[model samples]
Target: MNKYTIRKMRKSEVEIALNWAAKEGWNPGLNDAQIFYDADPEGFFVGEYEGEIVAVGSAVCYDENYAFCGLYIVAPEHRGKGFGLALTKARLAYCEDRNIGIDGVLENVEVYQSVGYKPYYMNHRFTVLAKRNRAKNPFVREFKESDLQEVLSYDRQCFPAARQHFLRSWIYQENARVLLYFERDLLLGYAVRRKCVEGYKVGPLFADNEEIAKEIFLAIQDDIEGQKIILDVPGNNLPAMNLVKDFAMEEIFATMRMYQRDLPAISHEKIFAITTFELG
Candidate 1:
């Protein structure tokens, strides 16, 4: 009989893991497979038992100093067999010597902590039905090729690491919309809304302040009125919490942003919404 083994997943195998993520109710973006694969082709991994895949995880190393771990899952029948633990260890080893981040579910918080991951803050997922908004700000416009550098520059201010490749594909993905808040030569913020398994999700809603964030949020939903909208708010940002409460968005899920080392220094208030819990 073949023994269990761990190996790096191929690009096509990434989608198979994403399918399992969808079945687990993660609501990943429809175009996430390619974008994720492009982020770090060598980041995704899988565990096979007796020649059959049974577990998966990711340890995307954005740069030498920073990495994110996520998309961890084990087939229901394979739980408690140590396959998941082996996969986790493999991912950790792949990301060693870097500050690793993960949005771990609350139930697994302690489990992660025991492995040297420290909880930094809570991220709450909120959902609401889109509504028509007559407000239109001339400063807000659809992303264009000319705006790539400016967007990346501003995005770096909000995100912890530089992920130009990931951001490039994320903005141009099919069935998605990327909007920017610019005033004259100043690129204040930007947002991306993508179709998910159920409805739509607005993320990486980085802004200079709460007002700009609100405008971009409502603007993204203007055309998708009445459709389900989801946003993951960081608990550390009071304005982000207030923004969701102002819309009466229902809280559906939550996770702890944990790290294996020192957390990267970033503009906490400017990160209105995280890009993705899976890849941080």
Candidate 2:
């Protein structure tokens, strides 16, 4: 048997890592690894044995208080061995603090729990109305540099800290559409959507009311071209919950956002959707 070694994932290896994620049925967004690495290049990693990569994952230490670890995958042929656990433990060690979080599949919760990981909370991904037949909202537009201060101010009210690096990388270009909601010259909310594995996903959906949230959804629907759309909504937010129901989106899967620490204090009142179970 060849000895296995763990190392930082190269930019070229992102495809391999993503393929592993796909086999796990994670349904990652398109260019996701790019966006993520662009945010923090050192976070992603992989395990290689001989000439083949046997396992992969990431430890995105956005900062001291909130670090996230996910994208864990091991080849099916190597499942029974200790490769998975070893790779995971190595990834965990990369995190600087105890605030490590992850959105684990139900099947492997116990496996993760065995090694210091714990249950945090459950999350859901819903399929919303397709925009093939009707026009989407006109308010939604591409993100621009001018919107920086506005987005920063908007993000502060929602998340605990200013994830400027993550936000900037995710909203890198005009393609990563960041929609804003306005009424009488006031910035009430914002939403972000991008292409991923299955189709388009709008995450971190933030809005002051159901109406604004609904409007942002409509705007995204217009661009999807009948493709499937996915969004993970927090179980506690009823307004955002009802808004998805209003649009006739179907709940496809329920996932638990597991964490070694308590869930951070986020503004559920204005948050209609979270960016992703893995990152946030």
Candidate 3:
């Protein structure tokens, strides 16, 4: 039998793990590695077998109270050998004492539950080919650098923790298009559209109502016209579900949002789209 060791991942290895996530059809953002690393530099871990890495996982602690675990993958050749379970256990240990959250793939829900995760809700991924549509909201405009503070303030109401660091990088990522909705100087909502391996994705879409969400969504889609666009919405958000259905987007996949303890207090009503299942 070959020896196996689990150790913290180096910054350079973050990209490798994200690549594996793409291979698994996760469709990770282009600049996800840096933001995730910034969230918890020492949180990602890798399992090595006889000097070759065979598995990876992340337990990124956002604050003392909340942490998210994702990017869990085992090499194709290393499957059925217990590497995945070991890596998961290591990640769980790393996130000890915090309310852990995971966006587990449908098939792996049972596996995660056996390890102490309980399903809170389901998030569905929807994709639509880009089509031009004029946004009628005159108040909608491109995001300005000065709006960062206001955006973060609104974001805090939607997420369980204050992820200022992640928000800074996410909004400024290369080839990203961000937009904000305002009414007479009051920031009503914001949305970000960024290039992904397969196409484009719009996320962290926070809005006060269905009208504002639709306006921001159309604006981003218009900005990135002619590319595929994807969004992940909570199954419980009826307005978000109706918006996707109105655009005729197809449901590509789904994940169960699991937590180790009681769910965190987040304003899901205003969360039109989740930032990233991998990090949140």
Candidate 4:
């Protein structure tokens, strides 16, 4: 029998986990390591066997009531062993009874369900070549430091819990651009575009309505024109589905959004895109 050591991962070791994710064709953002580490330095965990790290996972507690689990990966040569399960247990234990969420692939849905996770909905990842839209909305503007409070307030309507620290790191990370739509001093929505391993990804695209969502989405693509753009949207949001179809984006991937408890009651309609599978 092989003994596996499971424990919290150091900040610097996060890159190793992300590299494994990229090798699995997950297309992680280039600066994800720093941003994710900043989200919760104590949330990431690793499993080692005979002094060699072989698996990784994360269970980020956004608040006392909510946590998210993801980035679960085992080295290709280390799969089929119990290392992955050990890492998963370690992360779950760290979450400590909080309502934990995860975006998992379909093939593992049953595996997750067996461990007390229930599928809530599907999140589809769509991709398209960015094309500049000449329509410019005056209300859409670059995000400023002063807008952080209002942005975080608006974010809570779509997300499950307060993630001020994570949002701060996500918006200001290198190779990322944050944009917000404001009208009459009211924060309507915001969006983030970041460079990924392959191209770029726009996420956490929140808006009061489809028009506002479209505005932020198109505006964020201004500088990244001609690059591949990715968006992960909830299956239940019909408006979000229509918005992506209007852009002629192709569905490239999908994940089952599962939770260990009841789903959080938030404004799902406002969420045009989720942050990321590995972090949400």
Models 1 onward score TM values of 0.97, 0.89, 0.96, 0.97
How big is the positional error of residue 243 in model 2, measured in Å on the Cα after superposition? 2.1
The residue pairs in collision within model 1 are none
lDDT of 4 by residue, 141-254 (tens): 999999999999999999999899899889888878999999999999999999999999999899999999999998999787899999999998999999999999999999
Identify the superior model by TM-score, candidate 2 or candidate 4.
4
User: Compared with the true structure, what per-residue lDDT tens digits does model 2 show for residues 3-68?
Assistant: 888889999888888877777777887778777776668888888888688888888887777788
Q: Where does candidate 3 have its weakest 10-residue lDDT segment?
A: 130-139
**Who is ahead in TM-score, 3 or 4?**
4
User: Per-residue CA lDDT of candidate 3, range 1-280, in tens?
Assistant: 2499999999999999999989988999888888788778989999999999899988988888898998888999999898899889889898888999999988989999999999988999999988777646688899899999999999999888888888898998898889999998999999988888989989989899998999889888875678899999988789999889989999989999999998888788888889888887
C-alpha root-mean-square deviation, candidate 2: 2.5
**Model 3 pairs in collision:** none
The per-prediction tally of clashing pairs is 0, 4, 0, 0
Runs in model 3 deviating more than 4 A are: none
Number of backbone clashes in candidate 4: 0
Better of 1 and 2 by TM-score: 1
In model 3, state the lDDT of residue 181: 98
lDDT of 3: 0.89
